[model samples]
Target: MPNFNNLQYASEPGSPTSPSEDWAQATADLIVVLDGATARTETGCSHGISWYAEHLGKSLLLAAADTTLSLVGVAKSAISRVACLHPECDLTHPGTPSAGIAMLRPDGRYFVLGDVAIVAESTDGIAVIVDERVSQTGVAERAEVDHYLIGTPEKAAALLPMKRAELAARNIPGGYWIAAADPAAADHALVGHLGLDDGAPVAVLTDGAARAEVFGLLDWAGLLDLAVAAGPLELIQRVRAAENSDPLGAKWPRNKASDDATMVTASVAS
Candidate 1:
């Protein structure tokens, strides 16, 4: 029964006009982070990506209150709970609201679905768990989108077809599993237990903040160190600075110029 000393941070990259699509929530014994998948095309749900993420995050936290439930079971329960909230929405639509998920529970249990991640520091070294299936599924389409600069009309056109292809492959065998309309996708998450020394550091990150590592700003260890030292918000500030330096994707060549970033930094209580 490990308790946590945790700090959560989130920021949307572009305008402050709209709410962030990313969400992070935590209790004394649980931490969850979700990166709402940006819908490039029409999604059947009118509640939008942010609404779905908020509801799903709350549902997951509620489901996780039952310590007996496995992480997969919690995910499934949460997904089903959220689904029932909006029966009128066309959940079967390929472009319906979805998200990448990362969670940490007491007893050093961690789970990751889609591209979100859980990172922990152990005596062995830095350990990270994340599902890269989504990245692997949209290769050719992603390559096409990567050819053009971010935010350009050409890039938008390329992104449309890529998003369509990705939606088609999502939650299907040989494609990727995410927190979406299907509860079965929960079974595909990467779930495991790590042996963490008492007071060991852990972090859950959405791809937006994790992309700092992808963009070569810091490795996992360094990211953890930064969060431990300056705090999680500083890590996001660094990511924002990096993104500001390369506003056009001339260097990083990512799908968006900047994304909604969220991170939760915590430590096992001795």
Candidate 2:
């Protein structure tokens, strides 16, 4: 069985009331990391983004525990299960809470939905898989959100319109898929299996944890090395420090100064 080494995680809300919408679950044989979508518009459900994300994450953990179901099958079922919890709300509402997901199965297969990052290391090298469809689909909206940079009054003013557009794009044609009420979105997830010889040193990350490489702070190899040497929480702190150095995103523009960061790493047994 693979073991989680340097098993650590850190999650800070983008804002105090926002609630950290990221979650993770791990067993000797399974690992999952999820980043819940922030509500761009008002959701009819009083429970809000945090509520939906928690239910969805818990449901996913339960469904994936089955082990026998195909990954996609379980993922879709989980979406449907979460949706059933709120029959009173407009499930099709663009502001509905959702999440990006990454899962590692005992069979050496890994799956991804939305922009979650999954990296596996072996003698060959490092392989990172991310689904960019979400980012791509909301390009214009993202630009609008980024226009004034996070933390700026102007950006705050534009947030509602920008997020409305962002929310509108979900699950539509040319829009990206996510773990929302619609399970069919699971069909677009990224999936792959590791080779038997693909050794240990696997790292699964939320986008925040991946900023080191994504922002050119470290290469993939260095990321794996750092996780082993410093522990996963340290890696997140490093990101926090980096973001603090440019809180308004002057040097490195971004949607927010810091996002909820989370990671889980596992090493192959010898």
User: Which candidate leads in TM-score?
Assistant: 1
Candidate 2: regions farther than 4 A off: 1-6, 196-199
lDDT of 2 by residue, 138-195 (tens): 5666677777766788887777776776677787777778888889988888887874
lDDT of 1: 0.86
- Encode model 1's per-residue lDDT on 184-249: one tens digit a residue: 999989998987888888888888888879998899999888877778888888888998899989
Worst 10 residues of 2 by lDDT: 1-10
Regions of model 1 farther than 4 Å from truth: 6-8
Q: TM-score of the candidate numbered 1?
A: 0.97
lDDT winner: 1
